[model samples]
Target: MNNKVITKEAAAELIRDNSTICTVGMTLVSASESILSSIEKRFLDTDSPRNLTLVHAAGQSDRNRGIQHLAHPGLVKRIIGSHWGLAPKWMEMISGNQVEAYCLPQGQMVHLYSAMAAGLPGRLSPVGLNTFIDPRIEGGKMNSCTKENIVEVVKFKDKEYIFYPSIPLDTLIIRGTSADPKGNLTTDEEAMKLEVLPAVLAAKRFGARVIAQVKYLVEGGSLDPKSVVVPGDFIDNIVICDNPERDHRQTSSWYYDPAYCGKIRVSPQQETSKAPLDIRKIIGRRAVDFIKPGAIINLGTGIPNDVIGQIVKEKEMESDVTITVESGIYGGLQSGGIDFGIGRNLSAMISHQDQMLYYNGAGVDITYMGAGELDRNGNVNATRLGSQCTGAGGFIDITQNARHVVFCSTFTTKGLEIELNDGKLNIVKEGHIKKLVNTVNQISYSGKLAVEKSQKMHFVTERAVFEMTDKGIMLIEIAPGIDLEKDILQLMEFKPLISEKLKTMPMNIFTA
Candidate 1:
């Protein structure tokens, strides 16, 4: 067997200038940072490989790890990815019109990679219809600098679908925990194996170089066959990262945790709220009212995580619903913050693509996600907030397909304060910024589309509950002790269709 072992510098040399590189990562869980950073380092030193196009399914970091190293203005000409919350520096550049960024649904991206593996024209699906990704709504362009139409909406069988043009991809940057002498890779120690196989197959099928970064390199045939994910035939070079602790670990604050890898299940501990009850807990408390039993549910990071945490802490919906993140973990303990992609004691784990396929097929019964801004027409802007882009991770995929959808957010933001006074809610001080806007910065999810599909949608805020009607959003429920005209309607930029059967929110939700 030929030894595929090579230094990172030697591997980086293989990538030429103006190359298109596709990476696999779900928010830094299992990523090839050593290889990518090596390429970025080489580019900075030699100024070669400048103007490269980078593709990724999930946004991969918090400005310090993953693609942030490649965030240099000239290093990359364009970026195509699902989410950008983790990559803040690149987002700043995008907001400043320094680089071209294309945001796609995570499910469509995974399937597009599959299409690339099969040598197809491109992915054609309705996953992005009527949303910002729709050609009619900026065509997935993140900035004014990106003018080329990478995505187009076309009619297929009398139904409109978004078609992403296939770009000839050449270089693949991927990571695994171990690789044999022949380069068969195994990700035994990684958290979630996201976008690895499709990327490798696509790279090999297109006659591009595949560089495998691993923490351990062993002799040929030493790795178990079942453990090997990427075959040696598909891999061209192997780079061994000696210090995984420094080089490959997910984050800087902590190393590997057993709960993340499913090594052991940690029971969620019920803790009392010593701190003041904030907007998140209140929204979480109200959102749980929508969760139905025996449903396949998905929750986004941040507020959604808090909602699930509150559910578990209160011993509610413990067995009624199967919770999943876009990372493919099904019905396990939902993680929080940076470790948002994995689960503990996973009842099942599917490839992120497979999970997405299920979601795009309308397999999800319900979903609870967060939003940054909302318009009178019920459109949502969850990704961008006045140039701060938190790319739509699975926002389009989940909201577009789920049978029932709930968007959680405070009625307003920026210095928002609330007081819980003996089973009644009080807005101690109103927030200066109203999230109920005249028009969202970007339409991540289309309310018009949701109504067309006959989907049940609800907007849950700290003090109000809203529903989507045929015409527009209707105020259906207001929290107790909150005035209608003075508090709710006065705060919103536009008056909504008020429900004649308007009711007060359950006071038990606020009594704590």
Candidate 2:
């Protein structure tokens, strides 16, 4: 038998110091946890592979499980990631300027891998234009220590675009569901294909060593040809995790669920548990009213993923309105929070690279997302709010291209209280932190760009709904039993443009 399989420690030894290593995962799905843990242990024991660079598209940690294992100061010198909310330890390191960091759009990061595979100079797109990712702004730099420019501006045919230069990869650490004796990998048991294919291709192009971790190893010819995701010829080492239930979980919350991997289809009734009537439900109820029949929509993580999805299912509009998740899932109920990126009863599952192409090219009809901060210029700060930095995970790509944008958030955060009685809203206590401000700390969604493209933009809260117009945000509707001046205007940091024909939000939305 050809010896292509190795232990996780042996695979960890393949990495060299100061080399660029890229990984593939979304939260906890397909995270290669055994490999990551081994690498961390090897570094701690010998301190051999120090000052390495880590690159990942999605946030690949459940606080301390996945990539957070390498959060030691010398283990990683630089991090090129799309999101940072989950990796709290690395967030602290980046905040303290202990490591240099640069954040890029998640879609563009996947596209970068493809470009690297093709040996292209860079990947060009309009995904980050006019946002903080544009070089004119922060250039996706996270700390004062990061000096190199990874994102650039270029003009093509008199139009502007953001160019992400390809960074040479030295090592690829990826995960899969199974592997054959010859090293061919398959993802039949994984929830998402993620960016493992492009990552391997990129590593092969750069002559980088590829180390893959899988849950199972089978005979060479037993696996079907079409099931192979990465050919054995492209991989250098394969590690079969001994304890998959702990290290190779399907998601952060579950060890393995056949429904997540499309092995078994679940009923819509089982997936759709009605959310209790609350502020989020009210905001979701109001937001869903804007969707037309046959409209394809994208749902983001927070309120949009949970509340709006529940409302859509409760309304039985799954057949009428198509729902797509950024994780390349189509026509399935998306799980919320840490269990995100996996779903049940999925109609189709495509690679994230291809799914991003659809989002960047033709785009969706509308996208309902959550917002962290909103300013007077209509810019949103979903990535960075105060000291909490959650990098834009496809938020920039989705919101920038979508024809219509609706941001669902509470009027304030931290500690706010409200009551719903007899189809009216009463603010018992205002939130300590106001989300609406004069200027957002970071721009995740450019309100000016939305207005420039004539895209419809709406901000829905429990109390009121505001529309982004040519002038600014205009108060178009207010909830019943709410005082316009005390509960609405006084709570905001800036006064908004009140519509001449302001009306009350439909009372039915407040009903159970």
Candidate 3:
């Protein structure tokens, strides 16, 4: 039998210069770190495989590791991915115009892998019609260096749709927990099943090399057929990484957690504590109220993810509703910080591609997302922040089709401080930056489109809450101690319509 196993260095040698490499990873959960490091080392030593284009569906870095290993200027010439906030190196390169960067919706980017696997020209959908992904606005280009138009506005049957053309793939870097002698891969110990199958298929269908990174290799027939995720016939090379502590981690911080991979089940009650009541908790407590019993929900990063998941667990609502992460985790205690994509005690796990498709189909009843900025027109900018371009991950796709969207954010940012006394919120120091701006730098969520679809929307903050109306964004709720005119209106760039019967935010939300 021909041996598919090879050294990580040998696997790195397989990649050619100027080739397009697609990887499957959600941060460091399923990251091929050993192989990626080997490739980076090879590039640094020989500079043989230079000017490569890297593609991924989700943010694949924990700021320093994962894809950041290949962020050198000459090593990567272009990057086509969903998120960049985790990888500051790529952000620096993109900001410096050293590479061509295109930021597509995370869902669309995942589906594009399937499109490439199917040998389709491109994917046509209405997911990114009016947002920044629309060619009429920016065409998903992150900088002036990005010149090619990969996304185009097309009309099908009298309706408009965004078409994302598939790029030719040359190499696929994917990870699994184990590999059999015949090269079948299984992710039984990984945090979540990423888009590995599609990435392999996309590479093999296009005659590209498939590099598989596994924690260990099993004997022939030792692996169950049902457990195999990627068959050996498609994998060109296998690189075994034995170090789970540093190289192969369940998540960035977690070396290995049985609960994260469903090897064992743990109750949410065991994982959480009574979190201190703060601005985040206040927003999360208020946002949790929007979640109706039995509603299917998607929670974005930051306040929504960090606080709301804890609130749900604290409230013991795990069985009451289904929560999904874009990383393909179904239901469990969703993690926060660098371990955002993974969860423990998951109900189910699917491919990221399939999960994105589910979200694009409007499978979510309501979605709670964080916002970077909000304009008077009700447009939300979660992409560009200051001079840095943190591409829209799955925010565009998740929010666009959800029946209802509740944006959880702070009224102000950059050193905003508050104190909770009794049931009142006292702003000690106002934030230097106003989140409510006159015009957002870029529109991640279109208000005009939301109004047209009649999607119910709400903006929840520590001090104020606003709801989207046909006329405009209307102030509906204010914190108990906040002055409507002095605290809220004066901080925003434009005046918001006030509801005649505006009420104080539930006092319970302010309590610890």
Q: What stretches of model 3 exceed 4 Å from their correct place? A: 267-269
Q: lDDT tens digits, residues 1-512, model 3?
A: 45788988899999899899988888777889999999999988998799999988899899989999999999999999988888899889998999999999999888887888898998999988889899999999999989988889988899999999988889989999899877888989988888888888878778988888888888888998898998889888889985768898878988888988888998645776777888899999999998888998998988877888789888889778899888888887788878887887888988788888899995599899999999888999999888788889999999999999999999999999999898999999999999999899999999999999999999999999999999999999999999988899999999999999999998988886
Spell out the clash pairs found in candidate 3: none
How does residue 47 of candidate 2 score in lDDT? Answer: 89
TM-score of 1: 0.96
Candidate 2 on 477-512: residue-level lDDT in tens? 999999999988998999999999999999989888
Q: Candidate 2, 239: how far from true, in Å? A: 0.4
Question: How accurate locally, in lDDT, is each candidate?
Answer: 0.82, 0.89, 0.89
Give the poorly placed runs of model 1, Cα more than 4 Å off. Answer: 250-253, 267-276
TM-score, model 2 to reference: 0.98
Candidate 1, lDDT over the whole model: 0.82
lDDT of 2: 0.89
* TM-score, cand. 3: 0.98
> lDDT of model 3 at residue 85?
84
